[model samples]
Target chain A: LAKTTQPISMDSYEGQEVNITCSHNNIATNDYITWYQQFPSQGPRFIIQGYKTKVTNEVASLFIPADRKSSTLSLPRVSLSDTAVYYCLVDYNQGGKLIFGQGTELSVKP
Target chain B: EPEVTQTPSHQVTQMGQEVILRCVPISNHLYFYWYRQILGQKVEFLVSFYNNEISEKSEIFDDQFSVERPDGSNFTLKIRSTKLEDSAMYFCASSDEGSRNDEQFFGPGTRLTVL
Candidate 1:
């Protein structure tokens, strides 16, 4: 499993774009970068996933550089409800075990 | 969109007592998992069940913890003897299959408190 490192917390204003970056220097070739959003007292929800380059979905966008050592989750036009803990997970297919790091707590303030 | 559902949103039990957490995964899904998150901590995997058997499990799942698909629709996690440290929120998730890109849908969770 690739260990991921991210900020403990971040603050952003409503309508502002938020980008949370995760570093996985030991990412394997078969590993895929995935992001999950978790609100207080709720299970983590899948937001976006990508193997390389950019992949956009209705909720968020994932950008992975060529090296695949790092990836960024971009949330456009954030709202107060968007305040949640965001986790960047690597290798979701390895025995279906997702090792979670200390996630980035995004506080979207009004 | 279909969602996974768990019963007894909250459970309170005494130490050394037994407790069972129940979940009903999406009708068409085939993979089931159990995860727990202690207060002020990250989510940790407990076990994964597929085809009515366990495919994988983490160290957190010990002899005291067991999972079973007792029926066609119900998936259960039984703790033989509860401990104070076992208090946490247990989440149930299910995926369509074992494919790489399959997204796992999660239930709200069952908060277990052992006194």
Candidate 2:
């Protein structure tokens, strides 16, 4: 599994755009960038995933540069409920020995 | 929508006692995983089970830990002897495919407290 680095915390207001970036300098060709959201007392929820370029879903958008060494998770029109920890994981498409670093605690203030 | 389910929302146990955490993965999921989070810490993966066998495990999964699929619908994690350090939230997750490219659904988690 490739290691990842991300901010420990970020703050944003409701209706604003929140973008949390992750740096994985040692990413492999088969490694896919995946993001998960975890609220207090709940398990991590899958938000969006992408290998490269741009991928958008109802919850977030993932942007990957041509290098694939870095990716950003962009949340559009944030709400108070979006307050949670966001984790960025880099793993092989075949999946094994997945590791999670301390996620970015996102606080959406009113 | 299918979801993973775990029993005993919270469990309090004495040191040296055994504890079993049960989980019901999404009905169609073929890959099952167990993870734990210490208070204010990162989510750590313990083990991954596929086809009734363990496909991978972390160093955190010591000899005292074991996993079993007792029935077709249930996956379980057994801690032979609980320790004070074992206090954490245990989460059960599952994915329809055994690949990391697939999305894994997680349960609410079982809070285990060892005193």
Candidate 3:
């Protein structure tokens, strides 16, 4: 499994765009970039995932450069409800184990 | 949207006692998984079960831990003997089988407290 690195915390105001970047220098070809959002006392929810380039969904967008060494999760027009711990996971297809890091806590203030 | 449901929501047990956590995954899902998170810690995978057998398991899933799909609608995790270190929030998740994008849906989790 490839290890991932992300910010421990980030602060964003409502209606602003927040981007959290993750670095996985040793990412393998079969590895996929996935992001999950976890609220207090709730299970982590899938936000977005992408293999390469850009992928957008109703909740968020994922941007992966051609090198695939790193990727960013972008949340547009954030709301206070979006405040939660965001986890960036790599190699979702390997071993069925989703190793979670400390995760980036995004505080969206009103 | 469909959801994964777990029963009891919380459980309190004494050390060396047995405990069973129950989960009802989404009706169509074929892959099931167990994960846990200690207070203020990252979520850790315990095991994954598919097609009536275990596909993979982590080191944390020792001999004391066992899983069973006793029937069609229910999956269960049984801890033979509880320890203080076993206190954590246990989450059950499921996903559709064979899909390229198998996004696992999680339950509300059962908070296990071993006294």
As a whole number from 0 to 100, the lDDT of residue B85 in candidate 3 is: 100
> Candidate 3, residues A19-99: lDDT per residue as tens digits?
999999988788888898999888888899899999999999999999999999999999999999999988565566677
The order of the candidates by DockQ, greatest first, is: 2, 1, 3
lDDT of 1 by residue, B47-110 (tens): 9999989999999999999999998999999999999999999999999886656678889999
lDDT of 3 by residue, B1-115 (tens): 8999998799999999999999999998899999999999999999999999998899999999999999998999999999999999999999886343567888999999999
Chain A TM-score (model 1): 0.95
Q: How would you encode candidate 2's per-residue C-alpha lDDT over B1-115 as one tens digit per residue?
A: 7889998999999999999999999988889999999989999999999999999888899999999999989999999999999999999999978776888899999999999
Chain A only: TM-score per candidate? 0.95, 0.94, 0.95
Count of clashes, each model: 0, 0, 0
Listed per prediction, chain B TM-scores read: 0.97, 0.98, 0.96
lDDT of 3 at B61: 99
lDDT of 2: 0.92
- DockQ, all candidates in order: 0.65, 0.67, 0.57
Give the DockQ of candidate 3: 0.57
Give the range where candidate 1 chain A is weakest over 10 consecutive residues by summed lDDT: A91-100
The CA lDDT of each predicted structure is 0.92, 0.92, 0.91
Which stretches in model 2 have alpha-carbon errors above 4 Å? none
State the lDDT at B38 in candidate 2.
95
